[model samples]
Target: MKSKLLLSWWNDLRLKNKLMILYFVAVFIPIALTNTIFYTMTANYVRTEKIKDLKLSLEGNKDNFRKTIDSIISFSTVIYTDGSLVGALDHTYGSEAEVLTAYSEVLNPSINRFVPMNKQFYNAYLYTDNTTLIHSGMLNFIDRETEQQDWYRATVAPSRSRKWMIYTHSQPDPSYISVIRELDFYKLYSTYRKILKIDILPEYLQNTLFDQTFPGKLYLLNPQGDIVYSSEENLPQRLSDTVQQDMTVIFSVFDGVDYLQGWQIAGVYPNSVIERSLLDSRKFIVYLTLANFIFPSLLILGFTRSLSKRLGLLFKGIRWVQNQRFDLLKTERANDEIGQLTEEFNKMTTRIDGLIHDVYIAELNRRQAQFNALQSQINPHYLYNTLDAVRMSCVTKGEEETAHMIKLLGRGFRRSLSWEQDMIPLQEELEFVMDYLEIQQFRYGQRLLHNLEVDERVLDIPIPKMSILPLVENACIHGIEHLECQGTITVLAVQSGTEAHIQVQDNGIGIEPNRLVQLLGSLESSRSMESYADGKHVGLKNVHARLKWHFADDFKLSITSDHSMGTTVEIKIPVSLQSSDDDIEGGIHAC
Candidate 1:
């Protein structure tokens, strides 16, 4: 049912409209669908890839941070195992100077060597309860206040099994994640009581924990969720409150148990940065969409218009042929289907024109032969007998002018018999009419006057024989023949741009307006063989029809007359119809 409706709609549309619809369907729709799918899949892929990349970078930074803590633990363990440091801490000095010598040799040398060797270290200190044994790197007198410190109590606690604890030290310099260990190696009672503290620089710890590749705030929290370090310098100390406020925020946490137990690194990435990265991808998608859809759409539109324009020309040619206007030719410039169709149309018009020409010439010849037969068989013998007797009698009475009129009459009758030529030069046709007018002048005497003004350049133009002469005769017979005063007839032919204008003007009794209109209407409507040979205005009709058919309607004949004034007949034909010198000479021979 849908197919039937679509087919009906398609049939109702014009060819160009149908082509545009098809182009949108076949070309544009698929492109749009493909771009939509590609953009969707690409966005998914890019988001997934970005998340994976961020995860990898965060993991790599965590590994470096864990390694730094492990290195600090390893250095503290090495310092703890040193026999010299342990012996020095356990020694009972004989004097203060002796104690200073032992401390300077063992404690100061060991701590200074390690502190200067590592940029990650802030300082190292050995705290002891022996006030009399003073050393450069050791806290010489441990008081009750120092014993209350967190690192000091954590290190000295008897039940503490853990070898390392992260704590801050403020003595020589503030330190982040300081490793502290109690120094107790003697089994018997001993006076020396000490603790070792290895300090780590906060800057080094931050550099190890955070990565520039991961664009966001990173927090290093202890096992109890206290933020010990953060990438954002201006961030508040309480990170849990910040995370809880905005639910849209996405973050990841890594617990550090393999290397530095009870530590967690949390990374929070801002949505704006992710959105900005996606915006870049969206821009890329838009560019791809334009390249994929817009450019091809323009190309398709151009192709569709070019096809429709050529088809439109073909349709116009068909319409012209249907209207019987085959003279306007179609040009085929391409070797495509439409061009081939145009070529076929041009060939058909040419064939039709050839057929029309052949038929028109054959009909004209047949009509001429029929007219000649009718005249000769019906009235010629009697007319010749009557005219010859009158001519001889006039000669016998010494009326030379009357005899000359008879001779002119005979010449006219004979010239009318020759119907072999269809076209004649303007020069010869005018001469034929002038001879006939001279005969009429003999009868009218001074009452009839005529003038012929023809351009020399147009004299040799080949027009249909008897085309203008008939108009001249009509002007004289119907217009000037019954005038009271001297009636004047003028024939003019001159070039008017690309056309030749030939006019016959008479100053005599003119036709009534209505009659003139009716006569012209008859000439316009009359195209049949019967109308050409039968009407009272048959000569004019024949001239008009012949000029129209010969010149493909390029020639026009106009008749204008005013009652009691005059009548004028004008003919305009294209200059292209003018014969060349050779054609003019051939036309003369034919005439």
Candidate 2:
């Protein structure tokens, strides 16, 4: 029951709302959770890799420090085992001059040669207890003052032959790493106590052992955990004092060398530095999540909105159908089932409307037929009788030309009033035009002149009734009527291959270029007769429209004119021949 109710509530919601809810539950929530999990994993992986790299860096620094110390110890060993240096320091000098000779020849040369060879060794000195030897540059007498110093006392301690320590020689001088060894290598000639002291260059030690490229503080700690060398400037000397609670510390201990057994290389990395490294990854993840959410949400919203709009239009169309409105509903073109339904709906409405229109048109045409039949009987007979009586009266009064004009007028009326056919032979059409032109000549006298050129082969070709008459009428009224001089109207008809060409030319004041353009444009328009009821080129448009309806694309009508030259209206139509027997049969059938 609960599931059914939930489904019912869900189904009651609009399409857009339903899609939004689904997106929130399915796409939005899942993507957010997945991104959070991925970000957490990425952060953890970066931190683990960073710690591993830091450990490797610390080990490398430790190895480098040990190597530097071993080089110093090797230099000291070389001096300790030297037999000449031992003999020099142990010799009992008879006089001060002899001591100076031994010092210049032996001790000074040895010290100068060895010290300059190693960049790490700062200076080397030998201390002896012989009071007869003078205290000079490489040779020093072990006096009461030296015995009291910390490095000297440490070196002279029992059972200890070598030691490395940070020491200062005097007050106000910076400290150096000093290595001291007791010179007891020759046991048989050991007459006096001798010591060797080698001080290492502080600058060389700092540069050789520490790496500045590491992202955190680095320290070289002594046996007592004191910072003997550091990468940072002005840092405290003890490791405990320099480290903070927010720092992560990693260290590597020195092994295999007895002197540097307890020393370590420690790297102190702040937590903020690790977080800074992860900043770019965090930003990328956030941007990816936003893109995933925003793009799909917009797509779903657009899709649902379009679907709902189309459905709404379909519903509206149904309502129109319910109210008996059969007009076609305009809709967007689509290829979906909904679009197909809309198309079928429009088709149904059109068919229904056409059926109702047909019924109404059939009734209207029946009524019009009755009115035309009655009109044909009364109007034509009355007109013919009046015209015949006028002709006879003119003949009796010796007005022969007037009688002939009246007879032509009567023939024109009879032809126009006969509504039996919409098409007539080319010859009959030209005859009617000739009679009309004769009447116009009488009206205009010497001002109007006309000529006709016909190809006898096409005289029997059928054309729309009254087609050529309108062109002639326009030439007389619009063309010749405004001219000061005589106007000549030429009618030409010819058969050219499978087509017939007819032209009506007038030598009169031609139309302006702009007006001619409008006239040509009006002829091409397919507007209803009512729309062009008050238009100037109605008759020309009517003839063109009738020709187009009869021949479709097989007919052409064109007008060309130039200012003060002349205007030519030409018609080209395909020839469709019919035999004389068919015409006779059609006539008899019609009668």
Candidate 3:
């Protein structure tokens, strides 16, 4: 039972639901796969790129720091070489106290204050080849070791090349290097003691290094493999072996400078620096993934919703029409392709309705035309000859009233043949019919009675003019003419909605049931060869044709007869008051 229900549920999935499922598989899945593969590749590439950029940035920063330090060292030499300052320091006096006092004043501010302002300058010692180590800042006095340092030896370089050179002193330190200067500013304890040492602040030096933006670990090393300046003071003293092998990384040893004194500004960065660069790539990946999720879903939903609404409207409209409720008219939509289809559908329906209406009108007109021709065949030639003979007889017998009645019979004949058109107002048509009945009454005055009953409101209702006259003619002629007793003809014009009903009933010799059936059969099929020339049913046929023409299937003509009672012929005509406007526009009679 559970399995059957589940199967039924699956079968019940709507079209849109099935489409959404397919979309997830066919479109979204592939897009996701493509993006995932691309994202994965990009993530790896970002890490590699980061490491490359970091190494390059580190190298550049290191070189820039070297150039700055070189410039500052060179400027110091230029200052010392100023003959005035040199001459004052070398101003010979046996005491040397004046020169010492002058030097003290120049060095009064602690090395902590200015020279190596970061407090990173571990030591500053003034040295000479003869005096060895003399005055020291950050230390009271220095020993022969200061003279033995690379800074001491490089200044008095054996080749005696340039006035100054920068050196890295990583001596007894996780520290930085200092510059050695051959000063002409020394007093004469002995003329040979000439070198001055300044421990240049590595941090200050690094700060002044580069104009361009960069990131790296910057360091200055002293000659004795001691680090004097290092951006990473807390990095582990022992590095992993694999990391140590990397040319960009330094573990324990102070890597030798490629130029200058064995100590130099060096930048070290490992592959780990790539982490930051990968972050930018990761952000982009996130954006693409979000687009992947949102973009296609929105596209699919919008497409389905738009198309579905258009299709639904069309279906709903057709349903409403089928229900005979001509409503739910939708205004045209512009953006979607479905709107065009709906527009086309509307056009097709309009054309079909017009064709159907035309065909209906045509068929009705044909039938009415046939009926009219039949009714017109009711030629009272015998009555005309009889009236002529009566008039002659009356003239001979000196009866003026009988002759006058014969003239009236001739007048009625002309009127019946010439009613203006098929469709006419109710009042005019009734008057025309009454005139013909009056003429018949005059022929047999006391033997017949004719009366017309009409609703006043229906007087102006337009109807086919001769549509009722044929049945009335049958009643007056065939109905009462043969009756021995007094005969009665009643004409009723009643209004129902937009319909006009005219009923003529007679109390006379009624028709036999077989004769009534013969009359009511399809008139075209009953027009037999035997009575082909007689044409007595002309007016009846004309009325039937006119009724069919005007009202199509919505109209009726019926003949009823009872052997004991009487005969009744009813004609119904549907009319519209709005046809006045239709006639004005179409310039044709309203039927």
Candidate 4:
């Protein structure tokens, strides 16, 4: 009972609204729930552990850096106070060769041979104020060039003696870190104090810091907070300005006291990188939970869309049927129940279309047979009058034109009985009209004048039988038949584009505008001959209905007139070589 109620409620909602609800329940709820749980469990714990790790990492780097600096100091001390190396710088030679030999043998050997405990030092230099000493790789004269340098000036200042300083080394390798100290052991101030410089490689400095994958940057800075060395080239010069405002910075002084006077290490942890790492660590759980429902959600969406699309198509087909259209549904057939229903719908429409066709043909034949019977009765009555007129003409004129009148009557009767085909050639229809006119001419001599002006090209096209005859009859009986003077009837046939036009023009009494409007209005109001009143606009309405029935709505009959001038009845029908076979009944043709 609960399941049925749930189904009833779901069915009551629209398809798109139902899909939206399903997505929110199946996809969004699980995602939001997983994220909330994951964040609650790990958010603070991850941040605290990460900051602690950064501080510990920076402390370790500081300790190793201090040890490396101490080794440079220890090596510098041995070279600073060497008695033999000092004597070589102090000795003055009379010849350049003597100076070169003494320094190369003593000064160069002392500084070069003394190896430090740490392998980080790559090279060493001694800057002396001896004018006669040559500038070899190890020993160089402290001339005006050395005095102008900041390192030289800082080292030679009286207040900075016996203290170590760090600076970037440019020679041999720019990646080198240099440790400098001034020599203050000599009592003679004039001899000029020497500065000792030791170069350390970048590889040794990098080993003391964390790897590149670390979420923060590590650097060694002096007491002034200027970066002396960094683990990576991309490291920010100032942590406070370069890092985010919420970023964590861990700093500590060096553990080795003598080696690094005020040098320290700093680690910068940007909040963005930390949060990203924390999210990455929690991705497996969140995705695993979401993965379980993704396929099912997609399936639901697909089913909803399919059902809506099929129903939409079915509704469209029903609307078309309401408009009397029976075109078959032309969509792809699916494998589900809707597909079966669609097939059944197409079959039903086909069956209904066939039934409508059979019924329409039956009704059309019944109307045609009824019209023919009426026409036959009129012909016999007209025949009796023509014979009587002939007999009267014989008695008065002594049979002078009896044979001619009888021949015209014979032709009219023969054509009237030739209604086996509902459609005949335009030429034959014109011939039949001429025969009738000739008979009428004998009765009212010199009062009725009729002429046929038909284009030869339109003579061969098929038209509904007796289609043009009614228009001629209407022109004769309503128009010329009531005239006081000589009445003229003109029949004109021509082909205009895809249509054939046959017009009957009379020069006699015409209809009044108001009455003419009523006559044309009747034609417009009812196109079916069965609705027309007997003997009232029967010829005009019959011509309109027959043409309309045969050619659907593509045919037209128009009547135009002037008050007492004349009347023109024009009929337009589709030009065709042969009539449609669908109108044939049991090997006989019907319109």
Evaluated with TM-score, which candidate comes out highest?
4
For every model in order, what is the number of clashing pairs? 0, 0, 42, 0
lDDT of 2: 0.81
Regions of candidate 1 where Cα sits further than 4 Å from its true position: 13-17, 32-71, 87-113, 116-120, 127-137, 140-162, 168-175, 184-194, 203-226, 238-257, 262-295, 317-329, 333-591
Ranking by lDDT: 2, 1, 4, 3
1 or 4, greater by TM-score:
4
Each candidate: RMSD to true structure? 16.1, 17.7, 18.8, 14.8
Which candidate, 1 or 4, would have the higher lDDT against the true structure? Answer: 1
Candidate achieving the largest lDDT: 2
Per-residue alpha-carbon lDDT of model 2 for 1-31, expressed as tens digits? 9999999999999877888898889999999
Which regions of candidate 4 fall more than 4 Å away from where they truly are? 1-59, 67-183, 189-289, 292-414, 417-421, 480-485, 494-501, 550-556, 562-564, 572-579, 582-591
Cα-based lDDT at residue 180, candidate 3: 57
Q: State in Å the error of residue 214, model 1.
A: 9.5
**Please, what is the whole-model Cα lDDT of each candidate in the order they appear?**
0.75, 0.81, 0.63, 0.74
Runs in model 3 with CA error above 4 Å? 1-398, 416-420, 523-536, 575-591
What are the per-residue Cα lDDT tens digits for candidate 3 across 148-221? Answer: 66656667668866555555554545344556566654344335444545666655664654334445455544
Between which residue pairs do clashes occur in model 2?
A: none
Query: Candidate 1 has what TM-score?
Result: 0.43
Residues 1-591 of candidate 4: C-alpha lDDT, one tens digit per residue? 999999999999987898889788877787778767876677677877877776776676666777667667777777667777666666666889898788668876686576443444457778887777777777777888888877787776778635677765434433456788766556473365677877677776776555766667777777666665675565444555565687777778765475466767788777776677588657865676667567767787798788888988887888888898998888897777889888888998898899999999999998998798777668666775676677677757777577667767756665655555777788888888887788788877899999999999899988877777777777778887788899999999988999988889998789999999888888776655465655577766766766666777787778889989998888787786477664322122221
Better of 2 and 3 by TM-score: 2
Candidate numbers, best TM-score first, in rank order: 4, 2, 1, 3
TM-score of 4: 0.47
Per-candidate TM-scores read 0.43, 0.46, 0.40, 0.47
